[model samples]
Target: MGKPTGFIEYLRELPVDRTPTERVKDWKEFHHHMEEKKLRQQGARCMDCGIPFCHTGKLISGMASGCPINNLIPEWNDLVYRGLWHEALDRLHKTNNFPDFTGRVCPAPCEGSCVLGLNNPPVTIKNIEAAIIDRGWEEGWVVPEPPAVRTGKKVAVIGSGPAGLSCAAQLNKAGHSVTVFERADRPGGLLMYGIPNMKLDKKEVVLRRIKQMEQEGIKFICNANVGDNVEPQIFLKEYDATVICTGATQPRDLPIEGRQLKGVYFAMEFLGANTKAVLDGGAEHALISAQKKDVVVIGGGDTGTDCVGTSMRHGCKSLVQIEILPKPPTERAADNPWPEWPKVYKMDYGQEEAAAKFGADPRVYLTTVKKFVGDEQGHVKELVTVEIKWEKNEKGQFIPKEQPGTEQTRPAQLVLLAMGFLGPEQALLKEIGVETDPRSNIKAEHEKYTTSIKGVFAAGDCRRGQSLVVWAINEGRGAARECDRYLMGYTDLP
Candidate 1:
């Protein structure tokens, strides 16, 4: 422990965010870093508890409770408090291959399970983590560490998202020649396209890491869709082992009336096209602008929140978000206790900006859209919605029951569906002959990570269904270790 009484002496502090009005004008990241001295003070708040539940990486009540990649939270915090940033970065990289991505996007289950958070605020672990990695980049501490000896084994990773990148990185470190295939024109999957640039700078952060991985001998082939452009049988014939990490990209659809309106689009379609256009020298083509339009985003999740933020940047005239589920409590309910991720309401960046501009949060809970009303031009003009109540049907399945006299019509120029993904697209999996679970996810044991076919493994969203980036990294590393074991009949990777 850097200071035995540090937790008692210091309260948690975090980086400040740019003001709503100012940040909404640009697509750059809005988070401002704290001073080095104050950041050290925040790191000092780590109590170094005897158990240190923050890094346990366990699941409780079906939700993650700590760092999913098992980062050495206390050790890194102590190092940061003592101004040992390079050492802190080294320790942070020991488990997590990409702390920058998780630091920005993760919900921070570690903070929820922090020993200090039982009473006071939790240690600024995520902030400290981002600081360490950013410092490492600035100081030129991060570099390619290619394995010394070649194993003469080649592996194919069929995705370029966090999971695929992590798997390829680890396998390369184990002296295996690894090649990653991405169907998109660019790599990084959702990290490159699904996410907006303001949240994660594409060139500065993500592509920098990609360059380093390439230098470390990991090959990334873009615009190659296995089972389509590149034959799946060719991979099985050429590579010694194949690891599938294609993320859950299949979007859920709203099958209501007037669904085919020109102005309506899937959340990914809007976000992806906008990002691609931004990256293409700010081209007008493939861009979805919300300027002077009334926008309605369906579903209440991260993707929905991203839509809210993105629309605000486009100078939308009005915005409304609808959620079928009831609003969460402001505080943890009696059913949700300590050490579990709390199901409570919090204003994310998008809602914060919307509230600042519109005078209230834009989300309306327990509301279901019945149809997208369109004009003579075939563009969506309004949304017909009704309040709903959850009731158990004869089969005991909870279904939405429309409440009487609760119907309303709201004006809208654009509607984005963000209800989440179904599963990985089935074309590649079917061509590869991998079995899928009942949920349509690729069948693979969590620990072994082996598919029904020998020499083939699966991980990440494709294997585990839609999940967070941290879980994807965890499964990727686990699958890499298992692949190594299968190649050598034993392995040393953790």
Candidate 2:
């Protein structure tokens, strides 16, 4: 609303990123900052719609349609446009505890549902969002605001990923003493290790927020794994309430032949080790390196893309990513209408890097790895793949059918499985006697976030299965709200 014709006048623009060829040499963040004037122009592109769908936060066709945390998109857009920098940050913090993380990582479903996207390109919500928070940090406006008075209550948050951080943050804001326990050597759980450093820098961005949370009086206990060294029952005994945000760490495995080869590794295993090496003064020699190797990534998702990017940084000789599903259409098909996530084709950062060197996209659609070929040392040397076609079975379920004469054997010294996660690891839940859904997730209702066990709550991927970081933050805040109500018999958290 800052400029009535802003939507019509401004075109979509994104911040320039480091070229794929040059950025592949190092692990630094590739995204660059846009000048304030250009950023305001991007913010002005947000149409002052009669009914904004950008923040509706609904699920359509089994995918997120808008901002999962219901971010005040229009308000912040206007604030940024009108040069009310502080006001914009205030509005962003009202819903999102970490705009910097979301702006960098979240897929921005809000853009898919933008009203302006019906005709023209949607507003540059993601870029403008990142700019606003980055500016706040540069201006020193972001600081810890610990609660004024303690409520004399204590809460324990298990895990320190996006959900755990947001949950602990909100619980701390409610004037309750909050403690977050993470099993990792460093905090941030998935944020710390699951994602590569290039996507979310640990020291600069993730840890910066962690330091602020420490200042806000939230205690983080690292290397305190509940089911192993630290007793799970201690939380039930020592804290008034407990919220489990341990996320879906159990990765899905491809149980194929030669899976036991020494060179084959889980996506998390590869990504986690590489990030640790990057942070620990480049001790990458101790960890597995894709340097001078022909790497094959099994599964096509963000993790697969991360593998490609990480391998490129390690100076891999070649790269290939295999996908079981067919390639997505270039544009939305007949069934994929507006307000739903657009199932279209777009190359991510990893593919960009791979293509920059290899001269083509590294992904091959409708292909599945048949088996891996290993050398005498039990190290993977090659993999055989076969093209497949989806066909309906008698039960009307589509299943992959191998296409004859389509098998191809390719060189592969390392293989990373990035299919996705199954659910949260079950040892701690079983140790605590918490019930789990059939899907192996914690049996907690949405919004309420309470488990069958009294005084126990669950949220994020642990409760809802594998999802985006924005959704995890949404669940974290929602779980904090319910936990507050349960403890105090009322709540004011939104």
Candidate 3:
């Protein structure tokens, strides 16, 4: 603890985000970095609590309690406070292979479990983490560090999402020849396509990491579909071992009446195309445009918010986001105690942008869509919605029950379905002959990562179901360690 009483002296403060109204016009990252002095002060606020739950990485109440990758948060906080920037990065890279990604996108469950958060505001751990990694890049401290020796054993990693990238990176670090296969044209699976550019700049942030990985001797083969273009049996012929990091990508669909109407798309279809358009030349070249159209975004999650933001950029005439669940409380509920992920209400970047432009939050709570109304051309024109209440069924599971006389119609030209994924697509798993759980996720033991197949392993959303980026990294690293042990009968990966 560089500053023993620092927690009492400093208060939590984050860098001001670019104003919503101004930022919506351009596709740039909206978050501004804090100055070094303020970042050091924020780092100093890490308390000397003996049991620092900030990095405990436990699941409480079925949600993440702290850093899922077990990041040495307090150690790096102290390192930053002592003005040891290089050492801070060393400690950060020890656990998280990509702090830059998690620092931008992770919900920061670590802060929810911070000891200082019992009464006072928690330390700005997320901001400090982003600062540390961003600093490392600025100072040229981050570069390729290929292993000094090669083990001659080759490993193939499927899917270039967070899990696959981390798994490939770890296996490469263990001196094994690693090759990553991506179905998309680009390497980053979710990070490249799922997230919008304004949230995380693709050319500057995501591609930069991809280039670094390439320089480190990890080969990436793009547009390679194992079950289709590439043979699944190639693993047993060439690679010493295979690791499946293909993510949960099967989006849940709203199969109500008129679902076949035109102008309705899944969130990934909209988001992925937009990024591809931006990378191709200009956002104006997007496959589907929301310009001058009334947009209705279904499902209220990060993907929904991304749809709202993307629509705003496309100059949509009207925007509304529908959430079937009730609005969360402004503060933590009694049942959501400290150290648990607080189910508190906070406007994300998209909602803030919508509120600034539309004079209100765009989300409609306690509402469910009954059906999509189509025009003569068979394109979506409007949708009917109804208010609903949660009721327990005979199985003791909560379900939404629509209220009578509450149905209403709203005009919409474009509809984006952003409900969460059900599980990974089954084609590749079936071809690979890996067993799946009842929930359709790959059936591999959590820490062990081994599957029914002798040389095959699974990790990330494919194994654990859809989850946060940090958890994907944790699973990927764990799978790498286990795979290394299986390959050599001794594991050295951490």
Candidate 4:
């Protein structure tokens, strides 16, 4: 509450991003910086509500309603309004271990739950958050603060994504020797490989944080799969405690007709290979290429968007994204009121780029693949699709019902399955004999992080199923606090 009338005086504003056409040409971040005065004005829009739901991080209607890490929203808002960016960064770091990552990638449930959003637009909390951390980095305010003393205990984190990184970071801050093992060539599991570089610059943002963590005495062992390359039993013997943050990576498959076609690939396979080639400067080794091809991406989430963006960069001649669900309302519907995640339609970056090039939004909602029609050489040449409607089954379950006479075919040389992940791969969990929930996620209660076995802990997507980076950081920090408590008699970590 830097200014009492701030919300009344200022309208919400975000930094301008490069035009879609221009940004599609390169794999760099698009959003530019806002001037200090305008940024402070955006921060001032945060209403000084007596009950700030923006920071509550509660679940409403089975969806996250605010900052999942319970970031001190108002305090930082006030700090940003007062132009105390370093202080704002400090406050942000108090709860979220990686605001840099979240600021770029998070869907900002905080804005959805803002008190001001009941009528006016919500405050630009995400933009202000990114600004604070970016300012910290620019001013050299952020640095490694390794623990002053050793706890004489060792902990092993099995993933290098947000959860594993945050868990390793917090545990190391508690004076424990922490080691993170990542199977990828470099660290930052999904952050490094799963996501495209343009959305989150791998070198400047992700790896920079990793370098600081390394300087803080956290050891990252890359290209090491704990359950396969190394043994799970070895962790039990070598380390005093082991925290498994292996993310939910088992991608869902569309087992339709002609599934074995040459050009068909999992979304991760495409995204992962594209990122690897981009980083390694070896585009020739890319697993799949959308260049000069008609591409069809199946699904309509962030991953699907990534596929579209990546395809656009590869100079795909034509592209279409098929989504099984119906299109969302342009604005919040009557059933979706304030303080809940508004299930509304908003074109994301990839769709924006696709629309810029293709002259229309590429999504075909309420449609799904019937089967693949391939050429004589076994390459996908076209997709047979059918329109569908949601209908209640005998058991009162809503399922897709193909509408009669709604079948059609579209040319597609390459088909990328952007359907979401099922859960963590079961190999490691089964090898370690960890219990699993009905969803096939690790059977550990939320916030506790304890597995069925003593001295073993699980967190992140592996424990909670596929989720946002913000949620992963929340679970990671929570797991670290619990792990610290288990190792020592108490934990000072929040």
- What lDDT does model 3 reach? 0.94
- How do the residues 177-226 of candidate 1 rate in per-residue lDDT, one tens digit apiece? 99999999999998999889889989989999999999999999999998
Worst 10 residues of 4 by lDDT: 279-288
Tens digits of per-residue lDDT, candidate 2, 374-424, equal: 999999999999999999999999999999999999999999999999999
Give all candidates' CA lDDT scores: 0.92, 0.93, 0.94, 0.92
lDDT of 4 by residue, 381-479 (tens): 998999999999999999999999999999999999999999999998888888999999999998798999888999999999998899999999999
Which parts of model 4 have CA positions greater than 4 angstroms off?
Answer: 282-285
TM-score per candidate? 0.98, 0.99, 0.99, 0.99
Q: For residue 406, what is the lDDT in candidate 1?
A: 98
- Candidate No. with top lDDT: 3
Error of 4 at 475 (Å): 0.5
Of 2 and 3, which scores higher on lDDT? Answer: 3
Distance from true position, residue 89, model 3, in Å? 0.7
lDDT tens digits, residues 121-215, model 3?
99999999999999999999999999999999999999999999999999999999999999999989999999999988889889999999999
Tell me the spans in candidate 3 whose CA falls farther than 4 Å from its real position. none
